[model samples]
Target: MSKKNKKHEPHEEHNDESWLLPYSDLMTLLLALFIVLYGMSTLDAKKFEELSQAFNAALTGGVSVLDQSTINGKTKNTPTKEQDNQNTSTLTAQNMTQLQKRNELRKQEEEDLEKLKKQLDQYIKQSGLTSQLATKLNQSQLLITISDNALFPSGSALVKPEASALAKALSGMLQKFPDYEILISGHTDNVPIDNDQFASNWDLSFARARNFMEILLQNNKLDPKMFSPIGYGEYHPVADNNTEVGRAKNRRVEISIIRKYQDPDSQVTITP
Candidate 1:
């Protein structure tokens, strides 16, 4: 008598999905961290800022790391475009000011040299030395040319007794410009000469230059340290050696007052 056997029912299974939610979140955070590290490795500030904003919006929907005054605990100060342009303008103004000052100095130098040339021309005219002496002013120097007969005898390096007056006059004028460098150069004709006093034209020319330079130094006002003597021998002739008149012109001495400040844009006219 009793009841029938109770029917048996199987238990229902339920899968756990709570762990997958956290796993997906961990993967997204890892991807964001990697992107931030890669951006830090590059030097481009603009690109780094763009990456920071993107990650910030995707992760926190708030201010970026760069906006918080730091990235990876280090602050960066990037100069604005206006600041760079201002620096460039300052440098350009400084350069223009320097150029204007230099041009003014050059103009004053030209006036001073021209005045000295006029004085020399007046003296030459009064002394009747136009045939023996000449003066020229150019960008590089103020040059004075003197014939060989004006300072030395034929083949002799000795300064003539009468030429002492000319040297004295030149030294007196040079005393006005004490800071200038003076070059006293001598030249000779191509004719070869072998004598007891000099073995070649080079020796004779150098001796003549030295003797003349010594006479100039006798004034004591001129600085001996500023003076230099050079001999070109038979080379660097201004005239042909084939003719007597040309050879006479070739055998000469030159005094050059070198310029202290040179203009790079100016054309240099070299005198023989």
Candidate 2:
């Protein structure tokens, strides 16, 4: 009886390897789980497509494959839905920051434009030169027009005595704002000009513009670096030169103040 009991005990010892089969399967499943996570972290489009299709075909409803296996005899695997939702939230935050920054820039530009308009109005009123001056405020700059009848003689670039005070006043005000670009532009009516000093309207208009630029520079109201003179001899007409009123309006010298990004439309810049 003792010998028979010993043989049974050895048989029981040989069958103990049954426990190891299930343990081996558990270890394989764990290895597959880690491999799937690593692949997701460094995914490529081709492999992702293959994996997605294989997992979908292996599972019900193409998802929720906790009990499903792949063609390679491995279980389906992926992150939880909650984890994907968190990643989406992070992306949304980054997008919102970019939009907010753009809005801030637009707000700043609008403020600048309004400030320029206010300054232009005050300068015109304080100088008491409204009768001789016409002011235009646009998205890019401020344009102040002084009629040719008020500034110079017909077909001549010579500055009149009455125009001296007007020019000086404008120059003084401009001197206070040195950060602006000042453009002196000359225009002429459609009337022809033939003279010893100026052969055509173009010459007359250009000379008038250049002379005014020099005057502004000499008076310290403009910096030579930020000043330019252009002549549009009968080319840019504010009114029809055929009519008396139009002719008067067309024959003009304009001092344009280019705004420096304070107008809402003038600043298309980014923080970077």
Candidate 3:
């Protein structure tokens, strides 16, 4: 009985620290939440994209557009064919402007050429030499024929002293134009020459051409380089060889003014 009583009377002192267990558990939970938030903030974009795609595949039914694609929050549209046509039209307008300018310049040049031709015709008519002198117009040149009696002496190569006034009148008109080429040619009748000074018609015809060329060259107003002289001794006959009237016409000098253009009006091309 004494042993049992001693065992029961033996008592232990209790320490109370139960609140620390719950507090430790709360701190551990807060630490875990902060770590999860940090992981979300520093997420890898590529892996995150793959994870989001897998999530959408598991849930969504429609193909949705990417979030960042809607820049300026506007709907995208395709370019129209009309815009391309307008660009082409602008280019065409620029080309047309250049063409118009070229066309205007060409017109101006042709007008100048026509006026020159008219001036030459006027001078020929006003000099009262229209009958003996004739003008032949064509695409290549303008030919003016003056009789031998008007330009030179019989069987002589010398250009007459009085011819200078006539040549000056012609040269003064021609000096203003440098764009054309001038040719003075001499021709003779079929009859043979019997002069002591020259042996044949060829010599006389050539001398006549040379003398006329010299006269034109001496004119300070005319350009010497554009003038050329040629002789045809009864070879290039313009009229019948039988009649005296034809022979007189054949034995003459001719002046040619070459044309610079085919026509007064024509189309022009322009490039940029």
Candidate 4:
């Protein structure tokens, strides 16, 4: 074939790869969109933030919108100083109310005790037993002291026949204060006694208290569980043991009505 007449074969047409760039970009955008949709469906702010951070780091290496939104939400939810003050004020008011209620209850208890004391004093005066019997009201208790000679013979635990009336009257008065704890205590002089019925002052004193308490319990209105008996033999004396008069004062029985509500700050002692 002559050179001028030779046919040139057309180069194979290049594949149209120009469309590949846009197609790849479209695929990437679609993947990102699906990921965002899946994260939103979870409804977890923390997970969403982490996913946004990872995606942003991979794409542009910058902070994500999700992270900034979460931070702003936390700041807005934080309690303010004014709100804190309001909460403290509420607690203080509640505490003050409780304290006021306690104070009122204590005052009412004191008034009730005073009324009972006055009634007892009046009874003592009317019975002409002022010399042998004495009453004193203090913060801890209302004490009624009776000389041993009035209730029993010398160095004896048995109550005199005539003293029965006194026990009945006292029991009747005590019935009015049903909730009060009654303590019947016996005391003796320093002189010791050894006899057939009692081995020592301790035995005599305890027997005397028991006998007296039994008389008080004869009244059906008095609760036996509320009463207790104690013996202080030649001890816990209110007077000196050196003189006869002091010995007489030491040999006595005491009935104490203990207070139910006591003030922690106040201690009062009143002489009978």
Candidate 5:
């Protein structure tokens, strides 16, 4: 019985599946790499140390990798509240020093003005010109008041020759205060006058102020820029216009030494 010659059937080869194990292992490693990179990118210093400590605990039974980086047993670059307060105190001290300097300068100015006033009063007493000349110091200025009869003739704008001496003396006194500004102001009584020399009190008062200012400017040491002339015709009177004595007081020339320093309360701020 020749079993119909055993047909040698060829066995089919099966595809090998062993490579899947390594592929899955590679995928897991890549995922772990991506997670580590993401954690590194977002971690702050404190959180980064915490994460490192966790890794250390898992790997080495709780030894920390960040233990050596701590300095002076504290975090670096963090200022305490006391340090901020010290900075503020330094600024306050500087402001107080500046305020003291300003106050000292103000006091010095007051002393200088008082000395000038006393000197002017002494001159008026010595020259027996108290009735004709007077000095008054107020908040805005030191004013030297001269009577119309002392400086000019009736109905005249021209300064009298005798008054030149007085003007020269005043210029000499004013030379000591080169930084001050001088204003020459003329005032007239309410009486109306029409004459060949002047048509109105305005014209007369302005001319008188200008002429007197010219005398004051004769000193070569005086700065012309520091002086000004103004005329108030029958206006800004210090006395009543109805009486002769008041009229005489009203008709006068004033030399005002304007104060360079102004009081804080009276100061005006001009906005542009």
Candidate 6:
């Protein structure tokens, strides 16, 4: 028996699943959104910013989403209010400690100056040089006054040959305060002076101050930078120029040691 001829059957049509591609992409975006939300909720500020940048790059084609939220067209990484307050408090505490230490050091400097003044006074008394020397301690400086005759001859700026011993003694005392600033100021009587060596009182006084400072700086240990010489030229007189005794007092040299603690805020200085 011959088989009957059969016609080819057509395949049945199924529903289209083309929408799944876009749907999957939407789901991926939703998942990224949830992750960013969770990161923000955790209050992890650093991690949140990192996640924001990552999602913005992945979802927005590398354009930053946080750029729209920027103030003054710049991103600010500002600390929270509580953190700022804590930092301020810590800084205030550090400043207070520094202030306290400065105050303590100032007190110690004053005490050292007082002790040095006493020692000098005792030396002057013992050496029988009290008539030629005097010491006074004030807020700004400790001044040592020496009669002109003690260091120089009449109308001469050169230090006396014997005064070298005195200079050495002073250097020994001053070595204890190596860091203190020293000022040697020279003053002359108002009498008109004209000599082959000096033209006027200004030249005489300046030469006297410089000569005295050179003697003090002869010690190898003393810092020459800490010393300065100034001349007052009979204008700055401690006594009247008209009298013989007053003129003698006016012609003197002053060695002033500056105080270490000079408070910028205070007008009153430590004195003894």
Candidate 1 lDDT score at position 198: 92
lDDT of 2 by residue, 69-165 (tens): 3423333455445767998898999899987887786566556545655666776688776666667766666677887878787777998877777
Candidate 5, residues 1-272, lDDT tens digits: the string is: 77886888899999999999999988976775576456656765466567667766654666653544443344434444577789789899999998788778767777777888898899889988999988887766788898999999999988999999988988888888888888888889999867887888888888889999999889998999999888888877888899999999989988888777768665321100
Give the alpha carbon lDDT tens digit for every residue of 80-185 in model 6.
6688899999999999999999999889889888988998999899989999999998768888999999999989999999999889989988989888988898
- Model 6 residue 18 CA deviation (Å) reads 13
lDDT at position 141, candidate 2: 65
Name the candidate, 1 or 6, with the larger TM-score value: 6
TM-score to native of every candidate shown? 0.73, 0.56, 0.55, 0.68, 0.67, 0.74
Tens-digit lDDT string for candidate 1 (7-87): 779889999989999999999899888877777876366667777888788789898656655544545565556777998
* Model 6 lDDT-worst window of ten: 67-76
Q: Please give the ranking of all candidate structures by lDDT, highest first, separated by commas.
A: 1, 4, 6, 5, 2, 3
The CA lDDT of each predicted structure is 0.85, 0.71, 0.71, 0.84, 0.80, 0.83
Badly placed stretches (over 4 Å) of model 2 are 1-128, 262-272
Q: What is the lDDT of residue 233 in candidate 3?
A: 85
What is the TM-score of candidate 2?
A: 0.56
lDDT accuracy of residue 207 in candidate 4: 89
Best by lDDT: 1
- Model 5 misplacement above 4 A: 1-91, 267-272
Number of clashing residue pairs, candidate 1: 0
Candidate order by TM-score, decreasing, is 6, 1, 4, 5, 2, 3
Better of 2 and 3 by lDDT: 2
lDDT digits (tens) for residues 195-256 of candidate 4: 78888888888889999999999999999999999887887789999999999999999998
Higher-lDDT candidate of 3 and 5: 5
Q: Name the weakest run of 10 consecutive residues (lDDT summed) in model 1.
A: 263-272
Q: What number of backbone clashes does candidate 5 have, counting pairs of residues 3 or more apart or in separate chains?
A: 0
